[model samples]
Target: MVLFLYSPLVSRGVAQSPLGAPRATLAAPAEASFAVGQQLDANLAAATAPLLAQGPSSGSIVTYIAMLSSQNVVPNAPMTEARGVVGAALAGDRLVVRGSFRELSSALRDYATDPVDPPNPNITSAFHIHRGSPSENGPFQYALEVTMNSTGRGGSATGDYRLTPEQIQALQNGLLYVDLHTTRNRGGELRGILMPA
Candidate 1:
């Protein structure tokens, strides 16, 4: 019976324990198209010139933000405290992906993604934006570039790359999703859907 009381972990929240409390990752900038825990300030001047410049006149544009969590991963990821939030917006011909995260098990692999309804996929390099539904896994379609960090089991990912009109639509329709891959879980550790806000 004493052996049954034994445990692999020192206990949750113990500093020396491997599965201890989560550490802080880089903070995601507050001034983005959208974000977690807060909404854009109600002010006209808040609209940055660069974002406004890429308005509808500059072809189709998309701005989205969502919370990432372990629950969203398809086939389910091993239980982890890993979580984060992501925001995206168009800048010129480039699409920027930015997010802050914490509690990853190890170094990140690829930030896999899925986009719906794009014909002739071209994204073969950089981190990819893939095509899939909330309940499905799909192929990569667009590219993104961002540095990932894991100091203290947390960091941020930021990248920019060109996106297509059809890809933008996938985001709008909530048919696309973003996920983070880690060394321990190459498939995905955290996932978030691009549903309309």
Candidate 2:
């Protein structure tokens, strides 16, 4: 009588050892796929393309865009229906700011004084870029200082300043913001967060 012993490994198609006994092969450990990571990287590149495109060929550049509004101001200052668009571009080490305003309060125009004035009241409305968010009330290091027109209905400003890498990174991370200041509200009448374009 002949008796045959069958091993489970042999049934699963595992190879036999030198002694004719089936051997089990260890399975590889599972790893997280890199496909998801690659997708996330692509998405981030797409979102930041507009801002990075402003950079100069010799060096890096970053761009920030903002919408001027009263509701974004710190301490919640009330303002007229004035609104504007602000654009800031940092190329190499130079930072450039530009913006246009509209529907500004008449009080701002009244407060604004010409340089010829005897007292020379410098109450001109101006634009500024602060280091922190709208709620944080950080220091204003870059000033656009755009003067309003006679109508107080519209104005524009352009200014440039030197910026370090840290400051540029802050701007890229949304840690910077723009503010519109008037003589009536020296603390800033309107504010907006700067974001990548």
Candidate 3:
């Protein structure tokens, strides 16, 4: 019976918290939300086009943040209870989606440019993906998993999420993105938005 309101960056600039909104169970239709250059969509293609057009902005990181939510349902499990990872990567030009693990898995990433020197390496993080969801109780909502890397595999330093070389290339060229990888019948889904970490 809680309600959460959002400005949706694309909608307006209202920085309000979307905490208590109705959700749907996997038993219901699965919905997805995506973030492109400026528009959000329910379709995957709508999310990829923007990346292709702007190649991660050279030594820069861009994130197509996806928010998955449900309608009329409550959460029966913890965010960690879900099995497997629910996202993909497109190396430079290739597109990959829905990589799995077990239940539902979430991931975040930071994209940095290749270092140029020892002092101020040219390689620096262009973008970052941080897990924004709180670890508390609430209705089912979209859990963010996976992030794009501009630097190919082996170029990463911190550990949490990993991307293949191909995936890194794809992200650099605006090809990689995260998608739903849930195996349950929950109603909440993913909504994406391209923004700064």
Highest lDDT: which candidate?
Answer: 2
Pairs that collide, model 1: 113-130, 114-130, 114-131, 115-130, 115-131, 145-159, 146-158
Query: 1-197, model 2: which lDDT tens digit per residue?
Result: 23233222211111111133332322222122212222222222332343355543535444555667888888866757666666555556666666666666643423344222443333333576779865688875666656567776557666667788888788767887887766566566778887754
lDDT of 2: 0.56
Tell me each candidate's TM-score.
0.59, 0.59, 0.21
CA deviation > 4 Å runs, candidate 2: 1-57, 107-125
lDDT by residue (7-125, candidate 3, tens digit) is 22221121112123332223322322111211222222233333345554522223333333222112333244322222222323333232222223333222233222342332133
TM-score of decoy 3? 0.21
Candidate 1 TM-score, C-alpha based: 0.59
Give the total clashing residue pairs for model 1.
7
* Candidates' C-alpha lDDT: 0.53, 0.56, 0.28
lDDT of 1 by residue, 86-129 (tens): 65654445555666667777766532353223524453322345
Q: Which stretches of candidate 3 lie over 4 Å from their true place?
A: 1-64, 68-159, 182-188, 191-197
- Model 1: lowest-lDDT 10 consecutive positions: 39-48
